[model samples]
Target: MSALTGKVVALTGGVGGAKLARGLIECLAPDQLLIVANTGDDFNHLGLSISPDLDSVMYALADLNDPQRGWGLAGESWQAMDALQQLGGADWFKLGDRDIATHLQRSVRLREGASLSQVTRELCAALGIQHRLVPMTNDRVSTMITTEQGELAFQEYFVREQCAPAVSAFRFDGIELAQPLPELMDWLAAPDLEAIIVCPSNPFVSVDPILQLRGVRAAIQAATAPVVAVSPIVGGLAVKGPAAKMMKELNMPATATAVAQWYGELLDGLMIDVVDRELVDTIETKTRVLPTLMSDLESKVDLAQAAIDFARQLD
Candidate 1:
């Protein structure tokens, strides 16, 4: 029998998180999984509201994400980007022709006064994704990266600057007024919730923003389900983004133990990579060392199963 049988709530970001999300979808029934994606990376580009993390998760679930690039649809064409470049338009963030359709539809719906969650649901239905995927909140919560140069928007620091600036700290603007999704709160309060898995995403920008939402941390702490996290850092390096660099810039060691410390008491257990097995004794929470790297589909599935199994054992 699968260890992940009951309803599971997963908090995730883009790329790394989506890869594991795909694995979880493969392992669990459609109704058994609920994904809450980070919206901190969202921004307005060319008058279109682009949600990078949400699109990444949705594409992964729909089997349309490009594995090589770790973002955007597979077999995508960049004709639109090329045309924009020809017109002297800013192309720092490449938006492919296929991806443009998603943004266009979402922008129209949003302009028509639909909530982000509602629009996301419609998009998921169109993409044939069975599992539920939700943004952290409908309200705007931009990730502000404070660096030596100055404060830069999340996308500017990440994409435009190529993360070259020395990171000092991070702040989620508008987070104070941001509300957690009503369904998410209800799920946390549900009596039969099996687990809450924090995917291997960037703690500072991705997962922290979700946890920082009003009443979210308290809800997780009060939940009946065990909360588990898969460390994004493996062998002192991040699987994709600049998580490791951020950790170092913030005067923290880039290790799985540091990640466990970041999540602290909210986590009942943590799944670290085998490469960081030696640091297990230092982790405050219950720890399971496994191959956390998701280089391929099979690896992603195995790691997902291992995390679910670990969370079940915690109960």
Candidate 2:
């Protein structure tokens, strides 16, 4: 744990982010980490609200995550999805049976006028996840996809479209009206905050939405804690997901250097995988090299310890 006893760390995005979040959870007391999930991915499906990123983080933290799949509940069944398919519904997104329980409860709570943050907290408590898991906002903020084909909903671009669309642009609808969760802001200003770790999530889609929130980027910039990031791309490819594909489609190089450039001046240090270790010296920004992959619990713990050690070096 590197003696980072009272540090407050904020994380963003889904699977990639959640992996590091899980690592931190293993090493830190639950209260020491605050997860600021990207609510821009929030959407309504089959008349029910769904927050993919939030659910992934929650599932990962509760130790109920499916390691092989990288997302959703462990031992999940597709009963509801199969039934929905028989009824001619859009089962293209693949919502698992166990995962549906979360959506069902969240949907009911939301219908009763509870905020997303409130519902999330309740869900975390029920799952026995003691860390603070917060949505970027309780307000509506959907990530709209602008591609060569046309503007599509997030899931359509990601799942149905299989991320084949040539990237044009993206915008968070209703973001102008969105406010950062108060608790997140308070934590950002916490006296005990040691460093802010931007998990190795997709820079444009995953992390950008949270950065675009009204005062979020500014708050992160102004915070006293040093901010660090792990690159999702390794050896010119994404460790997982379509991050590298999106970068190429967006006319950017698929390299650790590109990831550093995307983050620009925001990060105090950048962590790249051993595969890209050679490029560390060529990176445009101040950075560090480490084995970024967390294949097992031991590796996750080592990565978490490396992060804290890196932060201490900055001090």
C-alpha TM-scores of all predictions: 0.98, 0.97
User: Model 2, residue 89: what's the lDDT?
Assistant: 89
lDDT of each: 0.93, 0.85
Candidate 2 ranges with C-alpha deviation above 4 Å: none
Clashes of 2: 0
Q: How would you encode candidate 2's per-residue C-alpha lDDT over 157-232 as one tens digit per residue?
A: 9888988898778888988998988887887788788888888888888899888888888888888888888889
Check candidate 2 and list the clashing pairs: none
lDDT of 1 by residue, 1-315 (tens): 265658889999999999999899877887788899999999999999999999999999899999998899999999999999999999999998999999999999999999999999999999998889999999999999999999999999999999999999899999999999898898888887889999999999999999999999999999989999999999999999999999999999999999989999999999998889999999999999888888888998998888788878898
Scanning candidate 2 in windows of ten residues, the lowest lDDT window is 1-10
Candidate 2 lDDT score relative to the true structure: 0.85
